[model samples]
Target chain A: MDRNIARLRNRLDGLGVSLRPHLKTAKSVEVARCVMNSPEGPAMVSTLKEAEQFAAAGVRDIIYAVGITPAKLARVAQLLEGGVDLAVILDTVEQARAVAEVSRQTGVRIPALIEIDCDGHRSGVRPTNQVQLVEIGQALAAGAELRGVLTHAGDSYRGGGAEALQHCAEVERLAVVDAARILQHAGLPCPVVSVGSTPTAHHATDLMGVTEVRAGVFVFFDLVMAGIGVCQVDDIALSVLATVIGHQREKGWIVTDGGWMALSRDRGTSKQTVDQGYGLVCDVNGTPYPDIIVADANQEHGILAARAGSNARLPDLAVGDRVRLLPNHACATAAQHGSYNVVRGSSHVVEAHWTRFGGW
Target chain B: MDRNIARLRNRLDGLGVSLRPHLKTAKSVEVARCVMNSPEGPAMVSTLKEAEQFAAAGVRDIIYAVGITPAKLARVAQLLEGGVDLAVILDTVEQARAVAEVSRQTGVRIPALIEIDCDGHRSGVRPTNQVQLVEIGQALAAGAELRGVLTHAGDSYRGGGAEALQHCAEVERLAVVDAARILQHAGLPCPVVSVGSTPTAHHATDLMGVTEVRAGVFVFFDLVMAGIGVCQVDDIALSVLATVIGHQREKGWIVTDGGWMALSRDRGTSKQTVDQGYGLVCDVNGTPYPDIIVADANQEHGILAARAGSNARLPDLAVGDRVRLLPNHACATAAQHGSYNVVRGSSHVVEAHWTRFGGW
Candidate 1:
């Protein structure tokens, strides 16, 4: 196995659990097949588009990881009926009620994983909100089945250091186990207590109550993850393959075809220790040459230059020369391109097209 | 005309020039038909997918406005041969020579538009690079028809005020006319000197050398333009109609289905005076309130709250209620969805569905 993959696997196994990696970041089925089928029973996804792709590629047991939109319930139910054990995550009783109503009407018998708010802010019900469990469980019992509870330590990225990872794990365990206990005491079956985030899943000392651990981005880590001390730059697998289109020799700038349009306009790691201006510029094989952080990006053109912390000097880059850029965030960067130009050791081997679905 | 349409049209007409709006932003055949059949000739497209769509919709004149990629040359050539007056833009002499070679070998004349870098340090040949110009013109003369010089006052967007508009016009006039004059005086009969951008074309002071205009965002003005003083907030035509899905009452957050995945992660106006966070949150009819700018966005969720600039007092916004979001950049935002739910007048009725195209 690749050292990065082996490192991630060993880390996950040390917690006495298996990693059911999330496929949201790597939207490619070819990539997901590599992750999910690797000693992991199931995986998680942010969109039904991912679900459809992964299912088409023969991954059966999966979880629609994000909060479900009511409009997509029918399609999700269809996926469930197609013998692919699909479970949805919802934080609110209303959403659970909607799912239950649809399930009862169609006799779909779909299972749901109630979402727990590890943090106070984003989506998901607070684990401290004990009454929500009884209420939501009763609502689900009327129409759907309550599988257990799921929580995402999303703010884990904010806690970038090893200490931050431990902090995130503490929050995750408390939230997931607390929510599970609430559901269990409510006379409902809470079998699976799932919690995820690359940092927490990688560093958590115990996975006592957690049945399934969901983590993505470990396969292809990013600058944001590296900045947070979660993974080193070497773990990142993907890069934007771009040609040096032009240059501003006077400004010591190298121009490339990879712009904000190619790398995405996400300043995901900007507030962190290392702000990868656009992204960390590298050779075609993903080796980082310090000087080239694509500094300023317009629509179709990226300006490559040396930022303040850069130690390297790009001595040989010229127009028409090719390079790759390791993105700050994988999901956001991957979403910018319509297809993944998947490379197996540098030859243009295969392309995994992503059909991004969007609607009300 | 509706207030939105009239406001946009009046601005373009006021400038004494018409806009060749990009179907890439609007993506509606009916709207393209209306704009083309109106006073403005066909249009420009940001992508070949859009160019193909418009060509099939009976549009005669079209510019595959972005820099031509080598992989797409065959398709562009095919479109030209299919009787579509597809004018493609090229910046480098290398690009011109390559395209010219393609045109020469195929025995089909593809109208080539030379791109002029008018202060936007992205793509395009520097207007002052004359030795390169003669070589490119000679190459075009050898095979491809040197139709004209094209300059996008792309920087005009950054210059949203009156002075900025004037700056746009000056640059447009100088870059296009000067480049065209250079080729013409060198004995290459370059007739057209095309120039445009919403900021410049909508505020054109003179057209001494410009033959035609290519301004796309004018047809569907965005929050960035609105923030820049080019267009009023009410002039923004298209918006993402999003249904509120969940809420974190304590945090005063209203979650919506229109996530970054739907809106795209292009924070086009984040560096502007009024950073419309994600986008400008508006009512169904396009009227923006001070309460919302879709404060934060994730892949499957858009957190609607008080505008970052305004007081954090959100309205009685609840779950399941729908709201509209005016985009940061019309092009990037429109690229996220498959089609538009085009509304006529102030009515919520779907007058027509605009089919969109994707891929490079």
Candidate 2:
């Protein structure tokens, strides 16, 4: 985790942009402290629960990155009144109006960013849709602070190799930069220009107009990121420990207690060149078993088998033998458990237990 | 939940078999009390955590339905010593030996059921494999109590309509009964016979030699169950409440705060005749919108869109408007949440909060 944090931190520092590590993946204050620029962070979060939790942990500069709803404004106000510089993101005039109204009503100037669509992957206004972008910025400037513009290169996960990732990073940069430029030309405060996704954050060759980069999953890379060439399989920092409970020897199946409930249902690698099934199987010492994967999963049973057409012999895993399964998507899989049984390096010895929280 | 519970209970009662409702779905004690045959429970659980929690809540007759491992026997022994009749299931002689060892060590005659594979879906010994079946039973009877046999029609989820489900039910019953006969022929005691799957439990025409039925998801029917003709969409008792936060009008997308984090990534209905995307979107009153579904999901954002090729108009839902999303798999979706906001049919008011526990 420290190596991953350092890799991104070094890259962004060289690009002259600050890092606002997204805390949604590792919802642990201990982990947050390691990745943040300081103990009191300028971090990003997907849910208000994260924002509130981090705020209590002394993270003052936090942005709730998911699109905001009017009903949630009260909670945002409470955070702001508590002296946290909590900001929100929105793409619609309706949402901007709601933020402004809440800011006025609470007598707390709520800071917000206009979410820009980088590649039409998910939410946000298109960079070329200047009218709506300016309207939203103007509405926020009326009462709330129009702090900046933000965009995520969510489509970057679809492609592999450095060239494709660099292109995605460029598109991400241009989208938020263009929106920030438009807001500036319209005499609106667009002080912060943010963009990222784990792939883009690692592969970007430039961040000239961006003020900060945001990413979460890099803290614990998984098979999806490895599939997209952002990291190697060995670079993945998270895995679910499972015990062999039974076997279907004729069918080459070694069943384990780790199932979809333990490893999430995120088949993020199904479309990749190599599908890792539910996850890649590994020895307890964190060494991958060649071509072995969780072929299928029930609620509490994972069927481990050799990958199709692979001659990889099924390891002689007996009942009570322990194995680790690397997750397809770290964020989704990590959300399944309450705490991380942290182990340093490849040691099997006990280490500190880091608690992770979940909820909207 | 009450109505769905009663539906399954009445069906099982007519078949003269007891209902040992699986508590893995609703991990809430309140919901378990509603679904169990009695407060003391003849219930089935997928994880040891559920067995321990329910046992702490006074559920004595519990079965850990997942195949047992030697490492987990200590906990089973602990439960047994605590006066809870915690039975276990296993298909291998190795597991049987471990159970026997634990029973001998702890001075608790651990009861175990030999798992019989009704269909080649997942775990369990094939009923036709008499040699293996008797071997496992003999191994259990040597030190542990050989209770009977159990089988689940896991493949029933693949087929829709009554005839297919009834066939699955009969196959499940025959598989367990055949295994019990094999044990009896070998002069081994076979007192209990268990068979089920939600569809099989509901559609079984005859329970002939079966002693008990086990089904979990039926307590809160989901879209998958409805698609398979085991229940209707209106009968689904669980949903994720979401707030409309934004829109991409040109794309016909209504964005909500509920994502895979809230709804879960279980696309169980995708293989069915009518694929409900992430979920079926309903109004606050619980009436589903015409052809509307959550088409895509990010970590914390659900994109609500009309079903492909449907001429249904997108409802003008504004920011802060609430909607309920019926899940594709009740067990998977409910596992994502910490508690259920109990409400009466079609009412928006939350009457109580029923906490659900998770972990292995």
Candidate 3:
């Protein structure tokens, strides 16, 4: 997992770019420390649990990556009281009004980022919604301080090729930039222009106006990232160490303990070209060995087999033998367990437990 | 959760079938009590954590679902010593030897279930591999007691419909029956012939030679089961209650506090006619709305909108308003959170903390 995170960081740094990594995917406190670099680096969090954990860990700056709920405002206000610099995000005028009202009541000047639609994939205001952004800006300005605009290039997870990813990055940059300008044009103080997603971060060169990038999956890259032309298969770090308990030689099936219970049921690879079955098949060293994929999985059993037509041999594998499996989706795979068994090469190293909070 | 657990038992009573429902999914002491109406109702568990906890809670009979790892054999042996009638599964000759040797060392007469390949989806000895099963059986008979043969119809999850699922179930039954017959022909007593899966259990009309069934997903039915016509959407009980956090008017997106963190990244709906995004959109009271689906999701955010061309006039939902989301896969979604925030209508009833177990 460390290698993948470093590889993405190095790749982006070589292009004179910085990544505002989301700590939500790898919720490990140890990993977050590495990402934040001791002091609070600019990071995106999916929940207040993550924000509170990172903030309490002495990280000063954070962006609650998920859109903020009005009901959660009092909690966000509580977090602000801790003296940590935080930014909440939203897209609608209704959400802005709610945040503004909460800020007025609590006397908490929590900064807010307006989510802008880039790919029409999920949440956010449309790129051409100049009037709505102005309305939201005017509303939030009346109550809370307007931070800036943020957008996630979600579509970058689909298709293939760096050119496609690069195009997505350009579009993502335009969306956030356009939304920020609209807020500024409406007399709202908009400063930060944030865009994120692993592929966009890897391919983005003309981040001239992009202030910060908020990508997450690159930290513990999965098969989805590798298959989408974002990263090489070898770049994946996080893997479930499983033991081959049994096999049916008549029909190629290897049963391992790393089922959905261990690796999660994220079928992100199903849509990719070389559908990594349940997850990308790998050797004990985390290398993707061709033709070996987890074809099916149950709650606590993964059914692996050699792919349709390849000279992939399952000869060396036997009962009690161990193998590391690269996840199809990093976030899902990481969320399955309580902690990360942080390893170094083939050595059984330290185990870092991620204390997860609940009730969003 | 309690109500649904009872519903499963009642459904089984109606079918007049005895099953050893795996407690691995619902690793709760209280839930296990609800299911153990008969002697055979002693649920199978996948982890040693469950075995220890359940055994301590007075559960005598348990089949530790996963193959007994070397490190875990001692734990299983310990549980067996605590007056818990234990049975463990093994698929390979080497695995049988490991369990037998552990049993010999610990003097824990651990019962064994030799896994047979009912469907060539995951683990087990093929029906044609009579030689291997006979070898393992003879070896185990010399060291440990051979209880029976077991097979999980895992392929039933992807078999599509009743006909397809029935075919898969037949394969499971035949594989186990064939293996049992082979052992019987060798003058070995193979008492147990087990077949299981929610699809198989619900649709099986001929459990003629099968002694036991092992279905776990029935208690907390998910959208995946509903997608394949095994269960109706109304049968689902658990849902992730989320508040509308943000919105986009033009793109028609309502952002929710519950993302994949709460809902899980199980996209079993992708193969269906309408991909139910992250989950099936439900009202605040746990009723699925017509054509309302979560279109897309990130780590901690979900986008709720219409399923397809059918325009849905989503309720006047504002930020802070709560909505329940029925998940695509129950086990996956339930695993996302630490515990279930059980509710009865609008009142908060109880919090059933799932005691999860990891490692061998």
Highest TM-score: give the candidate number. Answer: 2
- Estimate TM-scores for all models: 0.89, 0.99, 0.91
Candidate 1 chain B superposition, TM-score:
0.92
The residue-level lDDT of candidate 1 at A92 comes to 81
Residue-level lDDT of model 3, residues B213-311, one tens digit each, is: 888878778888888887778778678888888666656777777777788777888887657888988778776778888877777777888887888
> How do the residues A92-195 of candidate 3 rate in per-residue lDDT, one tens digit apiece?
78778888988899899889989898998787888797888899899999889899999998888895687888899999999988888888877789888888
Q: After best superposition, candidate 1 residue B270: deviation in angstroms?
A: 1.9
Selected candidate, larger lDDT, 1 vs 2: 2
Q: Indicate the docking level reached by candidate 3.
A: medium
Which candidate comes out best when scored by lDDT?
A: 2
| Candidate 2 chain B least-lDDT 10 residues | B158-167
Best candidate, DockQ = 2
Q: Each candidate's DockQ score against the native complex? A: 0.39, 0.81, 0.61
CA lDDT, every model vs. true structure: 0.77, 0.92, 0.78
Give the candidate order by descending lDDT. 2, 3, 1
Model 3 chain B poorest ten-residue lDDT run: B351-360
Question: Which structure is stronger by lDDT: 2 or 3?
Answer: 2
